[model samples]
Target: MDNNLEFKTIIKRSFLDNSKRQLIINSDYIQFEDKDLATDYFTKFLSSEIKDYRYGVRWIRGAKFTIGRDYQIFIRNNENKIIKINFKSFYGINKSLHFKNYSGILNSLLKFYFNKIASDFIEKFQNQLEFSICNVHFSDKNIMIETNSIIKKKQNTILWKDVRTKDYRTYFAIYSQENPANINQCYNYKDDWNTAILNTVIRTILKNKE
Candidate 1:
């Protein structure tokens, strides 16, 4: 079977007195032929690994689980034809009074965290069945620069000093055919960031058709 997959990251930021940020990372859509096996494997995997990495899992009413409060995973059976699983993670930063260099730092942290999770998934399922990861993309960073504070109509409002938004788009295709060689090399990297980048690059290559 030909491989086609994609994942995306969406980032939103507010640059006001109360600076805030939110990030959403989504995995490539996956479909499993054996619903029972897929559910069991993922459930066990999350139960053992989620908490170890500062994430909590909540069993949401039947066959649905929530990860880290904002992230959610659930299974849906479509008339017994196929079973669909959706997984997503959300991270947010609240506004703080103290000035801190958080935008770049938090962005890197979020990327690292997302890559870690992806690596874990690959490690677990690479040998079991066919899977692909590709189309690496990040939404345009939305930033608002606070110009000045003013009282308007008896209300306080901050004027936008500057606003900018743009998308970061890249394409790469990876497939299970190049498994252990490509993936193992990435795992062998001593630096975490290097490992993440290599893994992502290899996956993108495999997903791409020459």
Candidate 2:
């Protein structure tokens, strides 16, 4: 895919804030309470943004769910031509994958799903083109993708701001097919649909908590 075109597609999708769910450009994570909520979040998001696309294209991926919350993986492929894969999941209480056993369990899950997404994309694209991952994690607390590099950075740099909410607390991770570079790349556009969906989900979660 053309870098500029991919950037544009992401930017366009990111800037639409009226969307029920907010999209974090360069972020490879998402969180939701359950599959139904996750589906509703994405469906409402796409409905308000893309009129030509159908939400029913989503499928039941052959992956095991741990009984509580699982990320709903959505695949959009067209016979070795166009393939776009996305993932979304909700976070649960004490769902912290790491902080202690970061590498053994939490990181392992991250790496597994991340690689799963990449591998599936390769198969769908006939192992020809390089694809990216979009991950969303909806949690009140921040998640640390624990890494053990001594020369790593600590803080996150914000690139774009949400227009409606004007909040910049979200984090993003951008991965390439080959090299590892600056993952904190930010954008100027706001994904309205993502924000709306996220705001709705979070609000509901908080209400339930009360």
Candidate 3:
């Protein structure tokens, strides 16, 4: 990869043959363009202009076949302009075709979003005593999550010692390590953009604790 790497990709803008877009990503900037319209989708942005960002990845496999390879992302720049990229391609024979550019795009995208920010978020937890994103809340010693209690709506407070994660190819779930037979809750990667970051933050913190 050079200073800037470009890839031809599809932007999920309805079911059409020309859902094409061009992505140019570098260390400090990104440019997404509508190849069909010859106009900008996410015109361009510097690192400082990024206000909020989230991404999700899904690679499902079984036996000797691949089921799905999907990548989804959204970024909101300082101007409040947002750009979305859903690279699942179409269904059937073309479903996983978008994966051809998945690795390269995600590697660069992770560097763009995670570099230093991971440490920054960890630091925030250290300073403020908590961290929250995408409606998931974490504390210094436990994770507070929503539970399915039909009687009264409440959150399930799972201690760090009991918090166990399970990666189910297309989703992630947390369960009590003491009783792993029942999953507490699951977050589907395709639906939750920040699932990757949440996984990183939790894993990193767990490693430090260990």
Candidate 4:
């Protein structure tokens, strides 16, 4: 465990409010609950319970409010009840420093994910098993996608070597080797869950391509 990644800090709830929120991250889980003040009161979500996670630089409520890495995790227990804790941004005026905090916490979550889940996916892919994330499906040799067109959607299979991925500010798109200028699949950063893992899995597999 990296000492730098484990730190807790309390930030004021709002501009004039005195209620403080303590944000902490460790190798096990990320804590966002402030027992008395936290609206969601999410104590924590362990790696096993987490179904999906997303973090990136994006707008929260509207255009004026921008939060870096919208830190959120989707989790469900054995009962299949879901829980999500929303992020609270810092006050305006020289608020950039808070991004470091977001990065640190997110990195810890990343470490937990990589150690617990990511390696499993990578190993499964290497073992030639089919798996799906979001709407895209991965096979031993190719990625199956539904290409979107003006007229209708069509299923397409592009080999691992021929597949290409594009990342925009708000969307992640996959392209085939056909160069048809059609999107094999497009996923919104907000709506699509676990995009970070999807992107990493693609890159790692492609890098070690045989």
Model 4, 104: alpha-carbon shift in Å?
1.5
Backbone clash total, candidate 4: 1
lDDT of 3 by residue, 72-120 (tens): 6777687888766666542345545555565666677677755556667
TM-score for candidate 2, please give it.
0.19
TM-score top scorer? 4
Off by over 4 Å in 3: 1-15, 35-42, 49-71, 77-81, 87-97, 178-183
TM-score per model over all chains:
0.21, 0.19, 0.71, 0.75
For each candidate, what is the lDDT? 0.27, 0.27, 0.66, 0.65
Candidate 2 residue spans exceeding 4 A from truth: 1-98, 126-132, 135-210
Check candidate 3 and list the clashing pairs. none
Over 113-145, each residue of candidate 2 has an lDDT whose tens digit, in order, gives 333433344353343333222222322332112
Q: Give the best candidate by lDDT.
A: 3
Residue 56, candidate 3: how far off, in angstroms?
5.8
Model 4, range 1-210, lDDT digits (tens) per residue? Answer: 457657565555445556666666666666655456435644675656665665555445656655332444444443555544334454444356556655665566676554456677889998989898776788988988887667988888888778888888767778876764764677775567777677778777887884
Candidate 4: the clashing residue pairs are 56-69
lDDT of 1 by residue, 140-188 (tens): 2211111222442221121112211121222112222223222211122
RMSD of each: 21.5, 20.8, 5.2, 4.0
lDDT of the structure predicted as candidate 3: 0.66
